[model samples]
Target: MINPHKQQIIKPKKAVIKWLLDSDPAIRWQVMRDLTKEPDEFIVAERKRVATEGWVAQLLALQDADGKWGGVIFPAKWASTFYALLLLRDMGLEPTSEQARKAVSLVRHKVTWGQEHGNSPFFEGEVEPCINGRVLALGAYFGGASDQLVDRLLSEQLEDGGWNCEAPPSRRSSFNTTICVLDGLLAYENAKGACTAVTDARLRGQEYLLVRGMFRRLSTGEVIDRSWLRFSFPPTWHYDVLRGLDYLRSARVEPDEQVIEAVDLVAKKQHQNGRWPLQNPHLDQVNFAMEGPAATASRWNTLRALRVLDWYYR
Candidate 1:
């Protein structure tokens, strides 16, 4: 009773695997769990190293007296302490780590999404979808079930199957906002294990990305925006073709013919030396380096693009 038409997924190149293994321990642990289906001795050793000497340690060392690492609660609302913790979760920081625990407590006690304080267990008020999404990501990363932010995120999803931070006030969906919401939703689903609404939201969001061919209008076939084509580091939450497609590939969703054009666009960027460039970086202050912002082919961008293309070609 088995169907045999399904194509086998492409395994990452040996060099890629080695590169991942040789990267930071936190990244290595994530690649081992997300990209590799099996955990052997090598993976176990890498995870242990992550526990002992990863960015989590560096971040933990910076925590302030009030349990907030960045000296303020929800500092800027977009890319603040709340946002950083969300990204750290996606980076595969252990939820039980003291750093993560402190962040969770700080946000829970000191932040409010809306006007009322103590009105709801989740941040109260006119919550932005992307903000809710980030909080959902934090809760899910820490294995905190019964966190209702997941429901709030879904409620704010725009009609185009994406999200917009300005949607509540302006009622307009935006490419950048949609992408951040998608990333947060993916992290949430990965942590929750099973959720039908989350699954549907993710698929619809993917379709939105695909409908635009990752960076173009379906009707005009014109680039969506100059910014859409540019790649960036720390992403700081933006929608670029590279970031969006990278998400699709990580989710292991099958790429159809529609996605090939985008895949090809990304592949063409590889230099003769077989690496991708860093292109540009989002303007923000951050603690670490995920990539280099120069003409040289960056290791981070290269690894991400190669993995996606490899999956597509297979």
Candidate 2:
């Protein structure tokens, strides 16, 4: 029997659907598959456009000869190879495509973690759980991640049901670090099938967020961080309400009462014109500006917000 909550359909507002359909292939394909539910062939054809056109193409064209973007392999700056790959993953670049294969190969052969760690492989990951979590996601999707990488993440799970980049020093888990790891684990499951350990770890990480209503402090019932309420694209390593809720939506966890406040917050952000605005993003040296500074209507946020609503309020 179909699970009603899991399968509920929320037809987007007609104007919103039309607006989303008129954007980049990266956004348009997802709109069709997730929002409009277009025929499979239509969805497949649209998804293919991402490899050779739009932002994927723009970012791929920026790749340096050394398989890095913005002249570095990985760095604190947002324009580096790490972020470019993260953005491409979010854009839904077809993993099987020849174009994607070539772009990823460059990084596979050239990118490394630098001399500090004796030049660790890109997919093998670095010390920080936040960075390793993202590497696991990218590796699982574009190619595959090593078992050591996966097991390392699983072992890092905090007693509180999440992970913290500052675990030994700070026993508490962090929203940002936890979200990154959860996303990686989900992608790993999707790519290589699940394990009991992975599933259990994921559930615990999710509960950590759910118990806090995804935004407020568990103890004081006060907002944990106001920045979490705002939405952004390429979210980098930050965790916002929309990004966190969208992760829950992708995992298809049953919409529970715990998520009500966060879901409502997302709904209230939609403008009367059936759109959502991009909020102030973490400023970084990005290769290019995808949209105007906060307050502009954001196609990425609108698509994600609408699909999240579809998953939640059924």
For each candidate in turn, the TM-score is 0.80, 0.95
Off-target runs (Cα >4 Å) in candidate 1 are 1-22, 30-38, 76-79, 97-99, 102-126, 145-147, 168-172
Model 2 lDDT per residue over 1-314, tens place: 22222322265568878988887899999999988889999999999999888888898899877888888766757788899899899998998898788888988988888999679888888888898999999999997777788899999998999899998888899999999999899988988897899999999999999999999888999998899999998799999999999999999899888888888788888887878899967668988877768998999999998888888865
| Position 105, candidate 2: lDDT | 93
TM-score of 1: 0.80
State which candidate has the highest TM-score: 2
Residue 122, candidate 1: alpha-carbon lDDT: 43
lDDT of each: 0.65, 0.87
lDDT of 1 by residue, 226-249 (tens): 876667655665678878888887
Error of 2 at 258 (Å): 0.4
Model 2 weakest lDDT span, ten residues long: 1-10
